[model samples]
Target: MQTQDRTNVSSVEAAIAASQNYLLSIQYPDGYWWVELESNVTMMAEVVLLHKVWGTDKTRPLHKAETYLRREQRSHGGWELFYGDGGNLSTSVEAYMALKLLGVPETDRAMKNARDFILERGGISKTRIFTKFHLALIGCYSWRGIPSIPPWIMLLPESFPFTIYEMSSWARSSTVPLLIVFDRKPVFITDPAITLDELYAEGAGNVKFELPRSSDWTDLFVILDDAFKLAENLNLVPFRQEGLKAAEKWVLERQEETGDWGGIIPAMLNSLLGLRCLDYDVADPIVERGLQALDRFAIETEDTYRMQPCVSPVWDTALVMRSLVDSGMTPNHPALVRGGEWLLDKQILDYGDWAVKNKQGKPGAWAFEFVNRFYPDVDDSAVVVMALNGVQLPNEKLKQAAIARTVAWIATMQCQGGGWAAFDLNNNADWLNLLPYADLKAMIDPNTADVTARVLEMLGSGNLSIDNHSLSRALDYLKNEQEPEGCWFGRWGVNYIYGTSGVLAALSLVAPQSHGNNIDRGAAWLVSCQNPDGGWGETCFSYDNPALKGQGNSTASQTAWAIIGLIAAGEGTGKFEKDAIDRGINYLLATQQSDGTWDEAYFTGTGFPGHFYLKYHLYQQHFPLTALGRYQAIFSK
Candidate 1:
């Protein structure tokens, strides 16, 4: 047993050394880390549309992007939102249209196969609202076929049922500009060669836009949608001009100095197109700035190019800094100091939309993007505070002030259910999801267990204790939110493992004595769900189906999450815990690359539940290192 313990200790130490060195090697000169955030082929398709709308002859780049899209097509001839998932209808339609515009013939085998798959899945008519809107812009689908999203939504007051403040930051940022495009209904007349008629099914013409009557409240929203359409047709919308001006002002105000709106592809693209529709010349400084900002998202290779969904330097740096410190790096190490300084500079000291619902807290939160001051998120703020607290900075007084302000701000963002959302405080309005334009399924900013647990962990890391009212309420919320099978839903990460890990870690630090049973159950669940290879993985499909939770091929990141959760659950003395940790550590050691980092191709981050996903390239490196570090600290001692 002593010999076995020695082996385990050596294995963990080696992994920690390799991982730490690799992480340090990748740090930016400014002390940040950002890896490519990979998504579906839809980004490629959108780039094609952006070029076509602006009448640019970037054919060489377009052809390269088309090549990337074709390369990603599954055997079924369609693109999935993520790897190892079934083909998606909206992704397929958009890809087909983009390829057709790139001059791929209808008789091409790939195009023919894609057409068949789309037709069987109910054709272009069944695609998501965003895809339909894109088609409408190109004069393929009629604007009437798309849902009504008038600029007048901006005019609604806070007391109104559905105001701009009610939408999630991502949705709100994108919608503000989309309202302009929808009102203007701009159609850039492309060459006669570019048309989507060949991609649609025979009976697509008969398809009509109708409100989904998923429930009575939904039925009412449908009626409201119809009313809005009537008002639009008859020019009866109240404050129409005022609403348009307000929306334009809103969009212009949020456009980041980087030129992108909110630093996201959708918002950036929509804002550009919206400005164009409003008769802002292409040479307008804002339009020019927007074009320049988009150039940053594109990655051009010799043969193909891909666009990032968004940059994540701020978020990545915070996580990496935490991992490095947790892995036994000194708090005042040069890298640590640089990261701390960088994060301190990124802190938002001005009010954002989150203030609408949370008017009391002073601004000290952090945004995921470098320049999205109008929309700082609670999750990023918590992580940044935790990192700032962990590191020893030269300006200790300033760091403490930043931490205190962030903690206060996060407390204000807590909802009635004692949980925290990503961006807004209490932006939950389920009825709004019933709107026809909400096919993306991310309408409101409801509190989630994963984010709430993260906040708890952050608070616990600081001077806050379990006796604090905010921490106590959050504990109760987490207890009630746990699944019967003993895992929590991961709203931002892959699935149950991520949530369970986050909750267990936070509880261990904040309320360990009171959560014995919860911790044990979560530990048992993690042990039972371990893959045969001694690692762990969870599919994004788990978001849509609960039974699939904690089920998939083993991955480095998910496996690390499980190991860390078990360690936090007081599995120090148990045989199962000992065995599980041993196996998990060996798996990491076996999988580590020559450069000391692990390779992961799977999509582990959640964007909009079932509709969108993300692959944070740095996740594989930082998380596994943290897990190994924690294991060594407890067992090696």
Candidate 2:
């Protein structure tokens, strides 16, 4: 793993060899790898399947997962992301059920603590929308109070304001089946289930409600106790059948060959449960395929057990290789060349959902995977530009053509504010963000700090740099984006740490060395923010909650990201750089598993900070490898 033994070899070739090994070890025998995305969703999907498939009577994987979850409960008696101090409502409910599934008694100290916390926080009625839906199924909460997303919603035309495509990928997946299940209204009851009266707000289920005046859709589903009493008296079987049929078709149509629905497990689990409730047998091909997919998502450790949203070795490996090459690893090295080829082939030449959202661009961004058309984010494309710059392409004409096309595509996406949003530009209409069931807060937009820094860095590579209005505007955006505290805000990753790191990297290229510029100030802010653990971390709550202030336990991936930013700024010789470099390198070298991987369970990336976060398992390994390679190049020499 040492960087010194390899010399004069192309970084790409060396990267390919190393990445192949890395990918191979993680790949399941069934031909896929799983990564933890967010904590609550993964645990929820797994626990649901544990009860529905394995039966609630046993104490094996469910018991182990429950024990792990209970140990992670915060002082307030609920779980946060990655064993943090504060509790999130959705996370607590999901963990509570996983414990319940394992036959943990309500009188148990942990269970009692959790129940008290839930009651204190306005009860389960005030939990996030999705959590309420799950609680309703087990009779813990009443379905009447949940927002009205009637099954007829599936009948809404694409031109309608509430078309499925407008929703985020996660929401679309879950909403479709929820439409079916709610229409059927099959309430699963057991002796262990808690009643709505015991768990929700007093008199909550009986209360009548109306749509908020600001809602965009004219149709809203609300059920007063009087309204439900009247509807239940009238038999409407045919209408319910039609709604269920349409929703079942919707779910089956979207299921991937690999049994993924929107590449998120919650959608798949809920949809499969809906199908079974619709009387689809266990032997059904859809059910069989659905069950197999779950096996690929689980991760087992000696101390913890959990599942990831999806696996992504391809994306992680590419960025690590580029980081190493940028730090003077040779372009011809085996690892770099192999990684370059892998990435080159993965680029999206044809537009997908991103282009559809952008509405006016040619599709030329790098996807997270070889063929995922649903969510091709912008950060990966910027990273691809950096990676492509270092390796030699087999087809020079083709390479130049690809670079030109991709860079132009990114350039057009620059917003009025000068930064680049990941998927689309300037899509910041708050009116369009009115999903009642989704937990995501505000989304990333063109002014996002992380996107701006990445694009600026990529453009600095000479081939992509344009001195035109677009480039100048982008520069102005980055300059304007620097916070009064000398840090930038991270939209696609965590909080200030990610934002400051991104700003430093971008300013290093945009700010000329001749002028003493904001780069020094930005770098200093990053150094000041480092946690006492000799590593850097940022909490997801920083997206809108000013109170969180980028809080979290230190993690290796963020630590490496900070160091990489400093090195890219040409401060490799400074005291701050030296300390960061040594700490990051040592953390990686010491924590690496016997198989050359590292498992840092905390999420270091955010698709929409506070709204949607991800845990790229390989990020722990590849990012550190890249950072250490760069540090060794500068200091070891």
Candidate 3:
């Protein structure tokens, strides 16, 4: 080998060794990776609201959460949906209300600033539906002014244009109990000083719920909401008691073994409050179990406590397993075996909400959370399959069975558009997004380029030919979805880099011959976006404005993603690509801490485009490890 090749190999080997040791050191004895899932101050504030409504004496925790919120407050005087984001109306409104309820006086300067920020953003009335619901619990906002989300919607037939099942699993879990809350209209017992009248742009009495413009389907939902309100006022609703009972039953049935509903905070909290409204005593087993489950989501430090949006053991463990294997770990390595066994235990054999839209598919996917059987996402399933496929276990039959089932299930989940969605199939009822209760913008689970690419990658890893019908359709979908600038939209990650990287990587593996020019275009786009510092980063702002794609401070995870994408596109064979990969690898090496992990404070995970984001603390470590390992395997030859 040339001296330059020898040096590159040595550098790659050293980086991989250090990163592998770090990853292994952090692995749990049971062989799963559970990283900190961080979101915004909204989680802490919502926890405060949860305790206040449940009448729990969580004084100390509430105080700590209040402190955390204050500490996180941006210099602009309001909280944001994600770290480093500008002040958000809903998050700011909720934080202000939570602090006030915790006895922070309105006269306090911080409180005054927050209040000013709220008013400047059109005040409390302009907050999202969930925020409005929380405010109404404390009597700060009139429940009537919020969009109607009657529990009666649950009684709609499956054939109906809109039903609970038509919503995304997270939305379904949250909305079921929320509908019950809407019915009971429970008020928070608090001192009069806790009211938010002072934060209102206009007097509280002037607040009104107005219909949306009649230019689109949102207007129809708005009209339906008004009609529901009229029905509610006249007590002319049909089967009201039966609807409540059915909603309650649905919530109870979906309660996870871990006591969480779908293993998400919004559903867990909503289910608890809904049960309380149904007159279930605080000591009731269901309520007690629910509270206990929620307690697990709390991440407490010496002086602060914050709530995670959700746990991600299944997702994290699977990705780590793949990274370890890619970094040269053997298939029968103990860590791989243990991790593979743990993942096999997590597969969902029973059907879930995804089955509602895709009845033809069998039950064999995995959920993102530890016990959210009702919502096994396609992204998690694909990655898990990839991880399991890399491991050689003692029980060969069990491993093969798991892989076959997962592959078949993923195939069944293909959308009509020749792609795949995260949770459900054929769930792209765009008109449903106009519903008054769809303020979170997650009502529909539509096919996305990132997820479809991941599915294609999984199929390729399993040795499915590009000529297969499913693979062929997926290729078509990706080709049609590629943007004018040679990128794709990342639905679950940050932005164009994520989407383009994912698509390029999958095409390189599954449809190399067909996607040669496509890969070239994607590779060129990635190279063009490289930052001056030799690393790549895309901001959360890209979700709102495509112009910001691939434009931000360099981050270890995004840089690694760009590197992996480029390598997959055969850029490693070119001088420019080789330099880019070396620089990106060097960036990872230089940024490594004494403990061997890379530091990443930026949010890369997306909860909702532009509205919510997440920071998976492990992404910085595992992704770079995977990228470096792949680099070594490709070019170290």
Candidate 1 lDDT, tens digit per residue, 110-187? 999898889898887778888989998988888877777777778888887768888888888888988889888877
What TM-score should be assigned to candidate 2? 0.76
User: Measured by TM-score, how close is model 3 to the native structure?
Assistant: 0.96
Candidate 2 or 1, higher TM-score: 1
Model 3: how far is 613 from its true place, Å?
A: 0.8
Give Cα-based local distance difference scores for all models.
Answer: 0.85, 0.62, 0.84
Residue 175 of model 3, lDDT score: 82
Query: What range of 10 consecutive residues in model 3 has the weakest lDDT sum?
Result: 571-580
lDDT of 2 by residue, 1-637 (tens): 3664343123423433454467446544332233444445435434553354423324335445665776677777866754352676666766777576556777789988887777777666566666666666776566654554546556667567655555545556767887767666567754355444544445655533322232434233222323543454475433556766888997887776777666656676778768756877766888767766765666666766666665564466556656556546577765566666666666676655455456667777775543455555577788877777777766657666777778878876776566777666565545434434434544223457778888877877555676567767776777777787677777766667777777776667665463135676677666777676667777766766865654667777887778877776655224345576556555555565656566776777765555456666667766766676666666655
Give candidate 3's error at residue 241 in angstroms. Answer: 1.4
Pairs with backbone N, CA or C atoms under 3 Å apart (clashes), candidate 1: none
Instruction: Put down candidate 3 lDDT per residue, 1-637, tens digits, no spaces.
Output: 9897788688778878888898888889887889899988788788788787777746336677778888988888899887677789899988888788888888998998988888998898778878888888888877776777777778899888877777777777888887778877777676533778887787776867563455865577777778988988898878888889999999999887778898889888888888978989878888888888888999888878889999999999999989989989999999889899999998999988878778788998899988887889889999998998888999989988888888888888888999999988888777667667776777888899999999888877778533477778889999999887888889988878889889988988877877777888888888889888889999999988888878888899999999988988884224237777778878887787777688977898899897789999999999999998888887776
